[model samples]
Target: MLRPAASSSSGRRRRSARSRHAPPQRSAVVPSGAPRPPQRLPAAADADGADARPAALSVRPPGPCSPRWAGSGRGYANEPRRARPSQRLPPQGGRGPRGWQRACARACARAPCLGQHQPFAACRGRKRKKERERVFSLPAGGRARWLVLPGSEMAGLTAMEKKLAEYKCNTNEAIQLKLVRFPEDLEDDNTTFNPEYSHQVFGDDEVAFGYKGLKILLYYIAGNLSTLFRIEYTSKVNEKFDCVEADDVESKIREIIPPGFCTNTDDFVSLLEKEVNFKPFGMLLHTYSVHNEEAGEDITYQIYKADMTCPGFREYHERLQTFLMWFIETASFIDVDDERWNYFLVFEKYNKDGATLFATVGYMTVYNYYVYPDKTRPRVSQMLILPPFQGEGHGAQLLETVHRYYMSSPTVLDITAEDPSENYIKLRDFVLVKLCQDMLCFSPGNLMQGFSQEMVMEAQQKLKINKQHTRRVYEILRLRATDMGDAEQSRSYRLDVKRRLIGPYKKKQRELAKMRRCLRPEELTNQLNQIDLNMQHEQLEESFQQLVSDYRRVLERLAQA
Candidate 1:
């Protein structure tokens, strides 16, 4: 039978000394019935002159797995209705989306041995000792789409809307026509002509081909920060949508038009019919709000709250907001009221640098269909800005195009957007409120509360003032020095140390690991409450007072040391 090794005389003395002097190892898991290690937590102020009992740890493990639809006790549910997530729009990646992170961490904290609530999924397949890191993105399917439409589709949608309204109102055998949207390359003429003079060159050659086409976009952001943008546009009238650049240029550009821009967009639709010698139809506009990392390793489109990703990820989201603000400025500088053809279709590709996925949006103005002439115009409508990530106007080229094309052009009646989803109704019945006053400074949605709890209520009006759903793009860029170049070019200032980094910082890794086991913010609060309760009970126990006093004295001595 095995037995403890016989200890030499000096060894036994050393063991006894170590046991008497060393601090006890505190752990989440321990042998049952072992006297809970003497509670060593610092004493609270109210316990002065009281005997201390064993200090119990204020932290505890997290609970069980949460349900996909509801188990997340995160504050997303607590946000005000307008801030709440929409069924059509999933929770895209963001920074201020509080409850999501908190719930994920707290929930995972309850797991028996789930690692820290930090970027748990980063570098998943990477070797710990290896120097190579990973770059993550959402899985392909999880990547949402953001569509960009051209002019032909917008004109077509206007025509279709007018025709559909007439058909819906009366019963008549009417010849119904469709919209025309086209691929950009087909219209390119193979020659990358100058953006300004190209119009002069193609003036007589189907100048308004894609004018009536619309852009449909969808974006998916998987748990592992990968991005996919899927886009489809109207190509042939009453036919299929081809998102590619084809050879059948003129005919293809006449399909896939979207709804409409102005109330009287119909009034202008007929003008194009006779002038352009082509019938116009309605179009579609769709956009997805999903985000994935660009440079991080381990492209997981996961929802594991415990998993941590890059810290710079949050900063990236911030850049999106900045880019949106800049877009608003650029558009406002050119397309405001009376100048009615400047309907904006902002495609924000703030997640990945360059995308292989498709995006859905802008069927009304991707190509040249119909143009309302007003030189000094109404500004941009910056339709959708708040995002899974901050908004990005793709890059400076988009702005430069606006200046060279729209701003410099005459007879541009910058039109206002007409949306029916007018549907920005956030969840109405919100019980959670995890916002700050400062947050309202940017996203005014936070200022509203006391919404009707009924779930059936859809937005009744379209003219509602959007909670300044805009990010200060120009200001942020100025602060970050991005005004000098495109985001990629501007952000090229990576730390020299990044390349010099031999491996993952050991201290950072250890801290991340420890945070996995650290108690949550709410739990810490609960522990303080428990300690208060225990102290109250100890006041009645005379002997406990003495123990507390002794520890307080010991703590004082340690502090002095």
Candidate 2:
């Protein structure tokens, strides 16, 4: 009944449905777009020699003193694009679709200039000129700017986009791509953390592994700048700072990093400076560590055995939990721009089976950015997973994870998705069934027209009537515009036309709520009593409504006369 995905390379359209993973924590950026939440040095780190301790993770907040290149792009560096056609031969023995696409992409295209991106790269400036031909022509090297952010930081992305509200040209807010990082090597317990000797790399937020930790990578891209694209890794959650752990971290670094392999930051930086690298102006590399107290001590993945009850760790833990859960699972992403971000999610497991696109849900402008543009963060558009792990309810779990870290506000989180042809909207319904409390309303659909016959006929008739009405209104307005002397009279005539069109419908609706709620019982005695009450109330209010309606009629009639 099916061909194995591993061997099937028959031009199948492998689509990955968006699978949002749960964030370990939540970061609520209140709408004041307040300056990067002030950084208070961790109290645990306040002890002796704390200032001298290595920074496990550094905060790159938006400030006047922030990194100058934080948001300003370096354009497309010409290394990959500047290659000659001879480079397209792929050293004579390259294989696979990635290799093919790479060669094709690099070869036939008009290369862009190195060092800077074209200023007119799809023109966002207000000084519109008649130069339409240039937009189509690729500046010598055809490559354009690419945004690379971690797949999971949808909240931070959203916060950054809000800050860009005033910038009109930042239309490419949400970018889509299959962000595949296939490092040439890999790292593990047997290996050490050496950035210099690395061949390949795979990174999920701040935590990344180098070529010594070999793994296949294939995924999509969206509107994000993968900034933490490095070998050094960190996963921050709730933890009391520990010098011992830092030392252990350093020791571990000693093993993975072989001698003569780049040992220092400069060596690590060079790994990213390779010719075929996707570099964005900024990157928000976020990884979360939840304190699994119940799991007990001596675990390999454990971050701490210390008390989670401490205010700093516990409070920040809660904040992070909420941020991770809410942003990916529940946060509303409204892509105001036409930017459709590409995405790729590499699961812990890679099945040869294609990604079963379980659902395609969407949220409208139910939410806005809370931060201002000067802060300069990549606006998030999606929180999605990769192709290999699509059907196993991971998407829904991801949504729930987001809800856990949600920042409270009024938002309409709607999902628009399609299921397998045989199981249309089934998975979506399953999620809705589970998230009943949090869900607003959903519209399950099929590729069919469901209009009732009566509605169809009525709509057709209304279309003609609407056309006539529009013509009449436009003509009357045009006449009034041309003849100011009769403007007042024409205005009255306009009002008459409007009332004739909508007055009865409005009046009927106003009467319906009262009529529906004030019903009489069917029992004889009860009916009599209800009728008497209804009669009395109706008598008391009948004249009031009639008089008001009549007064309005008189006013209109008088104006016209």
Candidate 3:
């Protein structure tokens, strides 16, 4: 018995030694129809196991061991093994790839015996390092918790940005205007034009928000001036999308156009058919002709002075004045019920279809304010030449005709303009200089003698020109007569105008002297600091140069006239 036990022990030891040094066996292919033996997944606890994977990945859901992982020692007996990367299922709940990554991070954080296992510890370390890198890479004012948006939320933001980009439009380019003479004019693309400015109608930004491919079309008949307004767009932002409201284009146009305008194209065309019967309103004040270089013929034009009393004139005046809002920068309609308000309209007389037709060229409004005694000051309130007729010398003819009409009135004191535009001021200067050039006081010989009381008296008595205008005319005529190449003559002309320009500075100085007597010492110091005499001198020199430049332009135009 001792010999048999010794031999068995010795054989057991020899067998153990042989197993330690033996090479691993290869897996054999099984027959197609034969049943294979069950395969077991390697335990996650074994560091040196051939098939070991991370604990977080191994414990992921949809496996039998996943649900029991919180209470288990190793794994469930019937647990399904993890699928290969090529056969892995997509993440649930439509979370996408981001969700899968987040789920793995959470698994690593909640893993059992995380510190005791090498795979879990490595996963946790990698996750922490990635988190630290992400947090540190953010902008200075950003918080890690809210700075990074989820994949779904990020996609939503991208869609919103695209929507905003798709809807924005410039109001100036989007709005088109046309003057339709016949039915064919509407179909002609040549008739369509855009307003130069839209900030007056829209906001300062001039952006028509919340619309895609927007167009606001306004049409007016060439003769009767009947209107057709419409809006078009591919898409508009609505309450369903939580976007800003589109600009109220119709309301803005309504504020300028009168209520009697036709909104339909058919109705407007019908109105246009009746334009042949539309004649000049009130009494015919003056008639003139302009040579149209394009037409190679003289175009006849007539001016009419009308009040609210003429038949159909009130409605016509309303239609005429609507152009003021478009062309004039600071225009407002006057109360025509007052007898003092006078409307002067210019119309082009032409023969169309064997009948005489009158097209509106332009119009002006005058408010006769009562001066003391028996005189009336006729102030030019608003003047507008229709855009189609502008740059055609219609404005010059209209202003001169109006001046001649006003010149005939003995009760009129002088002509003035209410907040005249720079263009209007230039127009007035040209007209006044033209009229004054024919007078003895503004003769070339008399102009060299400098501005005089005789010039003022004659201008006020005959032309009803104010003292201010008389001074301007005298300067223009003087500039015309001046031999600018001669330094002595040019120096004399400049000194005369500069003397007038220096009056304001002298007046300011007198006021400052009075302030020194009245104001406190500290107040006087502040006031003194505000007035830089050197700057004033520089500004005065600039003003003189500008005035001289303007005078030279007037001379050039006068030479042409």
Cα lDDT for residue 433, model 2? 29
User: Per-residue lDDT of 354-431 in model 1, one digit per residue for the tens?
Assistant: 422222222112222353442343333343322222232221222223333443344443312223122211100000
Count of backbone collisions in candidate 1: 140
- What is the model-wide C-alpha lDDT for candidate 3? 0.65
Off by over 4 Å in 2: 1-381, 387-392, 403-427, 437-561
Candidate RMSDs in Å, in order, are 32.5, 32.3, 22.5
lDDT by residue (1-561, candidate 2, tens digit) is 101123233322222222233211111111211122222222332222212211111223222211110011212211112122222121111232222222222121112122122111112222322322111101112221221222232233333223222111110111111222222212222221112111111112212111112211111111111111122222321111111112122333233222333334343334433413221211111222323345443211101111233334333222212112212423322322323221212122111134311111111111222335332112223443322223434444444333322322123122222122212223222332233212111111210112123332332232211222232223222222233257764454444445445554466455554565675445434544444545544654564444334334433432342
Decide which is better by TM-score, 1 or 3: 3
Candidate 2's clash total is: 79
Question: Which candidate do you rate higher for lDDT, 1 or 3?
Answer: 3
lDDT of 3 by residue, 1-561 (tens): 000112366656766777553421211111222232332222222221111112322333222111111111223212322222321222211132232233322222222222222111112222222212110111111101111222333344444435545676888789877877678988898878777666777756676666888988788777667788888899986644332235467888888788877777888888889887787788998888888998999999988898888898988787777666556666667888889988888888887688888888888888999999999999998888888788777788888988899899999999999998888888899899989888998898998988899999999989989999999999988887889899999899989998999999999999999999999999999999999999999999899899888877877877876
Model 3 residue 261 CA deviation (Å) reads 2.8
TM-score of structure candidate 3: 0.70
Cα deviation of 229 in candidate 1 (Å)?
A: 21
